[model samples]
Target: MLDLARIIADELAVKPTQVENALTLFAEGATIPFVARYRKERTGSLDETQLRHISERYDYLTELEDRKKVILETIAQAGKLTEELQAKIEACQQKNELEDLYLPYKPKRRTRATIARERGLEPLADWIKQLNLSKASAALTPEAARYLDPEKGVETVEDALKGAADILAEEIAERTESRAYLRDYFLKQGVFASRIKDDYPEGTTKYEMYRQFSVPVREIAPHNLLALFRGEKEGIINLTLDFDETEVLNYLESREIRTKVPEIRNFYRELIQDGFKRLMQNSLTSEVRSLKKEWADIESIETFEANLRELLLSAPAGMKPTLAIDPGFRTGCKVSVLDETGQFLEYQTIFPHTGDRQKVEAAKTISRLIAQYKIESIAIGNGTAGRETDRFIGDVLKTCDNPPIKVMVNESGASIYSASEVARDEFPDLDLTVRGAISIGRRLQDPLAELVKIDPKSIGVGQYQHDVDQKLLKKKLDDTVESCVNYVGVDLNTASKELLGFVSGLTPTIAKNIIAYRNENGAFKRRKQLLKVAKLGPKTFEQAAGFLRIRGGDNPLDNTAVHPESYAVVEAIAGDLGIPLTEIAKAGDRLKSVQLQKYTSDRVGLPTLRDILKELEKPGRDPRAEFKYATFKEGINEISDLRPGMELEGIVTNVTNFGAFVDIGVHQDGLVHISQLADRFVNDPKEIVKVGQVVKVRVLDVNEQLKRIGLSMRSRDRA
Candidate 1:
């Protein structure tokens, strides 16, 4: 077998030792984030993305090796495994290659080739296969006539030749080289062509653009491919692959037909065409399509991953006293107030949009709640009646001396979170709308903490998320969430179970245990106290302690990202400076000027040392950006009010491959195509905008009936 470590190292462009050490750490139950962050010395300081590639490639290679073993055993038992064949099978690096090599030997149901082989036609087939230009003129009639056997169904010269052709055709189709060539050609040269189905008229369905689409298989965008596949699956489009059949047949004939003799050359030509069309075309086409689908799934998943990361790491409004409103017209708005720690303090229902009398009372209730809670911010859900409610709140704040900072929150998945089991468990006595209100408020307070409670798919920041491979999508989204959660360290004292579960090396069960222990034993005072939690041993602590923050704890280092294993080094650094541990944060320039190389040892390196120093510089500081929000234009509250060339401020709600969707205070998000994102050409919309970014855009066009508002961020006048 090929050396797995060497193969992975070569593929990742790293040393074998690095791959080996990382694998060993992974084998001992270490995670990607932990290995990437903590074990820099052992793994040559490979980052998380590199470490993940190594791990995934290793697993795939191992699976391929196991399959090779199975194929070798099966062929050897069948008495057809020759030394050359064994070598070929063992050298295969892909599943498709191995399967192609084994197709001739694999057991299957009865077919035309099987019946022909059972007759006395094997000798004739072998003779025909060995026919070269030297023997091109040799008469095949005499050799094929000997295979006539009435008992076995070959009753004439033609019957015998037909059976021989069947066997040779199957043999040609099963050739590994032929299948590989066709597979490559199908992927590189074929065209993905589609048209509207008979039942679905043009421009009637969402996939009208794809009705007459034809793109090179290699050049098709991942999003476009996924859309075409979805259209085909929904029976709205008739999709097919277009390629040069004559060219393919010529290539196959060149491999088999080596003679200029018309009889022999023409004979092999007919057989090659029959073999390809009958045995290879459909099968290879499907395989190529599946391979393309996998590629598309990967690209789509990565897009989702990037978007989810930005959304998860969105800047928080900080822990502030907040009033959250889930706005509605007929049902009124459900209001909830939360303290600085995001604990629900009060709830009420207000109807400020129905009547003048109710509006006055509702305004009074809101004002009283703000005064009672000393609210520092107001979070209004961007839903039905959201703009009207924001206007109403602006009016109410006009009379106040110090009004709270009011912002619109994109409440994409708030309702999903409200009705979730996690939500129900937290607020059993409260209504779903009230729970939703609290979520909106908490989202403003800390987006990472509040948004973690809902499924990422429900967040609605992906393109064709539902159409992608569900398993791959879930894994990628989960990994993204975990990465974001760990990137911004969690608060050990106040983090909910859902947020805590994404911590390095912490499972859902262990997260629940930590919360249980915290609830029962009061707040954790030190990072070391986590060892006492049930099912949380030393290893879990080692993996999770660095990412878990305990603010205002007994030890100041506990609040930073310094791992517990490195506390000794920190203490020694403080001792060298003759300052107490509590004053470590105060020694600003001294800490930076300290020689990082002097502290290097077997367990620590410059990377780890630099990280420790940086963490010490900003202990317990958030890695997210400063809080900012977009203020919607007051009068432009509906799509009907939108006009082309009007400039407006908005927040980006979602970013896709082709464009970004901006919530421009019209209750309908507008599309800013990639071409209009900036003055220069843009390859990706993500490079220009993110999920929570505030962008200034000009309305390029508006369709009030269709609720489509085209927007542009270019500096020039709208096109």
Candidate 2:
């Protein structure tokens, strides 16, 4: 077997030592985020992406080695493992290659070839393969006559020859070289052709775009391929891989036929064609399709991860007294008032859309709540009746002496959160709608914190999220959430268990323990308080201390990302500057001139010292962008209200490979196709836009009947 670390290092373009160190850290129970952030010096400052690549590659290589061992053991038990064969199996780099070499010896279940071998035809097949026909046109029946035995199920020479042909066909199909060549050909030269079923009329099913689609396997987009597979799976379309059969047959014959004898050549030709059509084509087609599907899943999952990361890392509106509203039509709007810390302070029902008298009462209630809570921000859920509710609030605010900043929050997964058990645990007596309102307000305050409680898929920022590999998707999404949560350190005193659970090295049990400790005692006054939590040992503390913040703590550095182990370094710096440790954040000028190399030790290198100095500059500073919101057009409340050539400011709700979907205050979002995403060529939609980005787009067309809105952002297409 190849050196796993060396192979991974070559693949990732990093040093083998870095890969080995990262693997060692992983084996020691360190996470990707922890290793990437804290063990920079040991791994030569490898980032999260490179570390994850190394980790994933290590797992795959380990599994491959285990599979190779099983295959070698099986072959050895069967007395078929030769020196050359053992060498080949040991040197195999891919699982497919190992399986290909093992195909001829793999156990079978009553194949036609197996029946022939059992019926005393194996000797006859061997005779024909070695026969050198002196007469080019000699009939093969004479030679096959010796194998004709009634007791062994071969009744005549013809039956014996047919059985021999079956054996040769299976043998030809199982040839490792032929399989490798054909698999590569199928992937590179095959074309995916899909057509709608006769039962589904043209442009009727949701898969109309794929009704008569044909694309080369290599050039098909990931989303398009996934769509075609889904259509075929749903029985609405017939999908097949089309390739040049004559070319494949020619290649197989050239590889197998080595004689000038026409009779033997003809016999082998017939069996080769039979092997390809009867045995190899279907299996190889499925294998190619499976490979393409895996690739598509990876690309789709990556797109989902990018969008999810952008959504999770979106700017927060900061902690402020907030008024949250879950907009509805007949059910009325559920109103929730939250304090600056996102605690639910009050709840009410306001029927702003009912009668004129009810509207007056709703206006008065909102104004009274604003005055009572001193609401600094108003968060309105962008759901049913959202625009109208925003307009109503706008009217209400017009009369107020000091109006708060009213922003429409995309409450995509608010319903999911409201109905979740976590929400129930937090607010058992509150109505679901009331809980939803609270979620909207909290999301505005801190998106990462609130969104972590809900499933990332339910956040509605992905493409074909439900169709991807659920286990793999969950892992990627969880990793994304964990990375974001740690990137923006969590508040030790007030973070919920869901948010705290994502902290580096913090398990759900430990998060719950931290919450329990805070509840039994008061808020954490120092970062060291976490050591008291049940099951949170020193190792956990070492990994998690830097990413957990405690504001107004006994030590000010606890509020920043500087780890406790590095506290001595900062204290040394403060001592050198002749200043107290509390004033470290204020000594930016002096600290900047201080050589970072002077503070570096064996464990604390330049990379870590620089990070510490940066953290001291902006203690507990958020890495996300500043707060911003799209100002949707006032009158465009529904799809019907939209018109061509109307320029509107919208927020990107989701970014897929094809385009960006922008929410322009209408209930439905409009598509800004990849071609229209920019004036120049845009290879990826993410290159131009991301989730939660406010963009300006002009409406190109609107199909109200289908609820489709076409939009463009190219500067050349200005109205």
Candidate 3:
């Protein structure tokens, strides 16, 4: 049926040829990052996001095709598959539509219709269904009597008519068009009504707002539906749909009953009402609710993915000798010191929040540790007593001659990482909080590297992450992580096994093997040495080598993003320049003299050559932006310290379907609603802001009772 490539192209607003070539490349096993970066010409310069969309849609269509094959095969085997029915099924573009087309032919258990049919009443029902349209008042009484047989359990005309009505109801409900029209009617015109269950207290819970609530079925926001569904599932509310049935009944009557005969028309009315109520209402309500929930899940998952991507791509403070603290109040703050390369050097505890007496001792201990480790930066986990700890550190640093830059780091999944097997292996003797502190320190040094150790779901950036489709959520988040990792090429000499797992074509086993080989034989001197890693064969090397950077390797090209397959071309240019590969780094101007066209071949094209030349010019450049952070306002340590019109500098901790949550050093994050995100209209907050973005937000309002703070970035002057 459909031209899949052309349909996808139209949806994405890309050329059909680009879609076709990208699909072909995908079928041939090329990864999205590879195709987006290396095959620009083939895809008409489609970027990574576009390529990902194409890939996702391609997978969906492929799965849909497989489903179609299964449906057709099963129907054909059932011996009821017709040419027209096959065409109808083939023409369906959606899973719901395809299933609807297969509904009549699907296997059935013993139901009312089946029981009636087995009792030899099919002819009588057919007679009723075909009542003469021209003459209206045709009596179904005589026809019902003919079907009454004592042997078949049709003991009377009334029993016969009842069975006939059940058969008719099932028939009407099974019609594809009937289901389609009614589903649309419900979606557009129906209302979702939820009332507090009888005998339930009014103010007992957060669901009080939904005690007597009604919203348009089509207009209910994702968050509202999720809350409502939770409420219904918890048995606190009685949820149901309300819609005008007159319109639907009229539509069904016009389609199913053509005859105007008064007697038969009366019976048809009863049949239609029974079908709508008994056969269709429950299933259709479930179907409609499921459809809406799917849309909401999609919205929530996309929000999660976007927030996670921003958090993962957050600016790193670079490799600096640092001290990190996972702050606490009563048990004392866990302190971890790390060297420039993130090697754990020491661990201790300091009672910064104990009192004025212990606070002085804590400051002394921090100063000694800083001096001993020569800490270039201090990272404090933004958890319990985080602001108070920061204040203490700032006061202590004020008394020092050479103070390090102290920063607060989001420790969202630091605990998860600390308790993980990876952490246990690395710091077997240390306490969990100490491992968590080390993770926080490493996170500031290189966020992408440290964040990969924890599952994206536990990263605390997702909204309703636990409630979304786990399989779809995992696939999407995995793709996002892989894309981010490859975009930031890993340093071959210093990358941990966990960091390398996301590299293209590299699995966990291969990652571990590479690290093992590194420890045994030292750093990889060139890209070719990757082949020596056990089980990292030619294909794996081909996919992963370009994304792995080996600084100061034997070949200078090894450090850049240029693939190994194109090393010959790079060497040729270096030879033409009459310089060694190491010296080729400074030979950008001299290399312009060579003809790039001469380098193009069947295997390597102009797009790839252009990338090679670009890499040669700025070899080993980082694609990530320069490191930066938000400076939270002083003295705003808790929600109680907040007030309206107080402008503060904060980092966005999470972005959602409705708004972005900004942490203003107040412990609790404030919501920057979509309407207040920008001066202009803002529908998607991701377009205007991202996680970890340092923003100037003015406080719009604060509800101390609810622990809610509303923030605005629209046309407000920064304080």
Screening candidate 3 with a backbone cut-off below 3 angstroms (N, C-alpha, C), the clashing residue pairs are 136-261
491-537 in candidate 2: lDDT tens per residue? 99989999999999999999999999999999999988888999999
Off by over 4 Å in 3: 1-10, 13-21, 132-137, 577-579, 588-595, 716-719
Judged by whole-model lDDT over C-alpha atoms, candidate 2 comes out at 0.92
The digit string of per-residue lDDT tens for model 3 on 530-600 reads 99999998878888889999888777888999998889988887887799887887986776676889888
Error (Å) of candidate 1 at residue 230 is: 1.2
Q: Any residue pairs clashing in model 1, and if so which?
A: none
Worst 10 residues of 2 by lDDT: 130-139
What lDDT tens digits, residue by residue, belong to model 1 across residues 1-719? 78899988988889999999999999999999999899999999999899989888888989999999998999999999999999898888888999999999999899888899899688888887777446557777888888888999989998988888889899999999999999999999999999988898766899889878999999989899999999888888889998999999989998888877777787788888999999999999999999999999998888888888998999999899999999999899999999999999999899999999999999999999989989899999999999999999999999788999999998989999999999999999999999999999999999999999999999989999998999989988998889899999999999999999999999999999999999999999999999999999999998999999988999999899999889999999999999999999889999989998989998989999999999989888999999999989979999999988899999999898889999999899999999999998899888889999999999999998778889999986435
Per-model TM values vs. the true structure: 0.98, 0.98, 0.95
What are the clash counts of all predictions, listed in order? Answer: 0, 0, 1
- Runs with alpha carbons beyond 4 Å of true place in candidate 2: 132-139, 717-719
Candidate 1 lowest-lDDT run of ten: 129-138
